[model samples]
Target: MGRRAALFILFAATALAVMAALSRPGVPQDRALAPGPRGTGPIIVAVLGTSLTKRASWPDRFAGGLSECLGREVQVTRVARANANSRWGLAEAERVAASRPDLVLIEFALADADLTDGVWPGESRSNHRAIIEAIRERRPDVRIVLMTTNPVGGLHRLKRAFLGPYYRVYRDLADELGAGLLDAWPRWPGTASIPDGVHPAPEAEAQIVVSPLLTLVAPGFGAVCG
Candidate 1:
């Protein structure tokens, strides 16, 4: 072919290649890219616990963190109360069963201590097991993640000492149930994750708990780590 003709052919091939690249999935286009896997459906995360979960800021922060990580809308429903226990969490789970959430974060370890008084340790375990079983029965496909509470300081330590067995029960339940566990205990000391030594601080909310928790929930959630 002549030089001019060859040049024209080369230009045509380049244009076609560019077009093909743009048309491929996940490739950015001038108009808009197709929705990613995360955008396929809305993720409903139900957080059940005590005052820590009730903290308006915690859920909001978690929502924001999940949104950033998943690159999709994250709806968080906080079914929590101040000074509540595992029984409350179980009730909340039962109520939420109908809603059919995509994920459930059980934050009742700290509250479980309260059950030791009225309920025996074995009975408390049974109650917690019943709750998990009920949730699974209601929504077989829903994912359950156990969230362990942060360690308490000073007087709160006394509560932890009493509640230690209950906390262990929570861990045991998670293991036996084959549920994902997110323990926020270790992140407390070195990092300033907890504000009043209970609820997560604003800074810690995004970095420590929110980001890591979502990452554990689903892969590729680490994209929101920054």
Candidate 2:
């Protein structure tokens, strides 16, 4: 095919892929991650993960944007620690559940893949399951979201050789446990460079993290273009 024809085909394929991704059934529609009537109270959001999440101003931005989009207040509580993994998160699951949030976002695959931590795939999987279970036990109506953050590269990538498997834990568990997933890993490289090989630069955060999440939870809200 000619160059122009090939470019057209690629663009068409890309559009189709995005459509397919968006069409996939996420958390139940009845739950509607957005808040209730105008008189109702704020939508409580709890974000639990590693430093990547702690640093991701996306949640605050998301809450603000979502509140505007849905015409309701969104209160966000972030419980994340640097260098922590799913194992550490499991210990705090009860605290998170006790907060009585309407929505919970979890991201820890990167930290779990740390070679120094040596949390194997199986153990990581179990930890995630336990954490989810603990939360669900208390708040059965909560809408949980699992996030796979930016892709790692350079020496950081080299160290976390099992990072792919670690990320899959979120995807698998999201399906198994009936949760939403913001699969940001595969979309990162195309969006921007992770100068540190782990974290996305400040400029890229809105696109790499916030955009897709906004698309997931609140469709039609103006997304941050990459």
Candidate 3:
């Protein structure tokens, strides 16, 4: 074949390969597969966390995004307290189970790492396990998701001295308990939007928090996009 024709063919083949790679079911592409049904009735999602969840309203956004992604109704219940940590979450586990959620999203690493809170890494791990066990005690079949939320900045970073260790507790426990995890600390491009150095601003929440959680859980629920 002529050199120009051969080069053209090779370029065409590479472009097709790239296109095929981009169209994979798991990847976000221009066209997405239709969402399949997730049983009957709206999905019950219980979110247990600290102020990061209570204030930003990502759980609500996640509910809507998930509904669209899965083509089903998604109802989110947030059981959160400002400055509460995993230790506090243990107290609310029974309440979370009482809601009879099909899925539970737990985000407490941020608060648990607080020096003033005094949770530390060991206690955080224990609290996380207890919370998971408490929820599963009543609802064995429920899907549990653990989240290591946003990294702190400026002064807040100083307060959370053991932040990395606390976040590791969630990451480790997620594997041990066979639950899903959204390790969102690294997902933040920067802390510029976190005015408080902890909670994500409204505009940044959807992209950084909600989208990644949806992407993580969507496959398990039998769908794509979040």
Question: Which one wins on lDDT?
Answer: 3
Q: TM-score for all predictions?
A: 0.70, 0.77, 0.80
Minimal lDDT window, size 10, model 2: 28-37
Residue 15's lDDT within candidate 3 is 67
lDDT of 3 at 186: 65
When sorted by lDDT, best at the front, the candidate numbers are: 3, 2, 1
Best by TM-score: 3
Tens digits of per-residue lDDT for model 3, 96-136:
99999988988888787778865767888888899989999
RMSD of each: 21.9, 10.2, 14.0
The residue-by-residue lDDT of candidate 1 on 160-179, one tens digit each, is 44444555666677778877
Superior by lDDT: candidate 1 or candidate 2: 2
- TM-score, cand. 2: 0.77
lDDT of 1 at 124: 69
After superposition, candidate 1 runs with Cα above 4 Å error: 1-39, 114-120, 190-202, 220-226
Per residue, candidate 2 scores C-alpha lDDT tens digits across 1-226 of 9999999999999966664453233332211133322345578899998888777768888888778766778899999998998888999999999999877899888888888875888998899889888999999877788887776667775577567777777788887877778877766543246778887776687666665676576632222221
Ranking by TM-score: 3, 2, 1
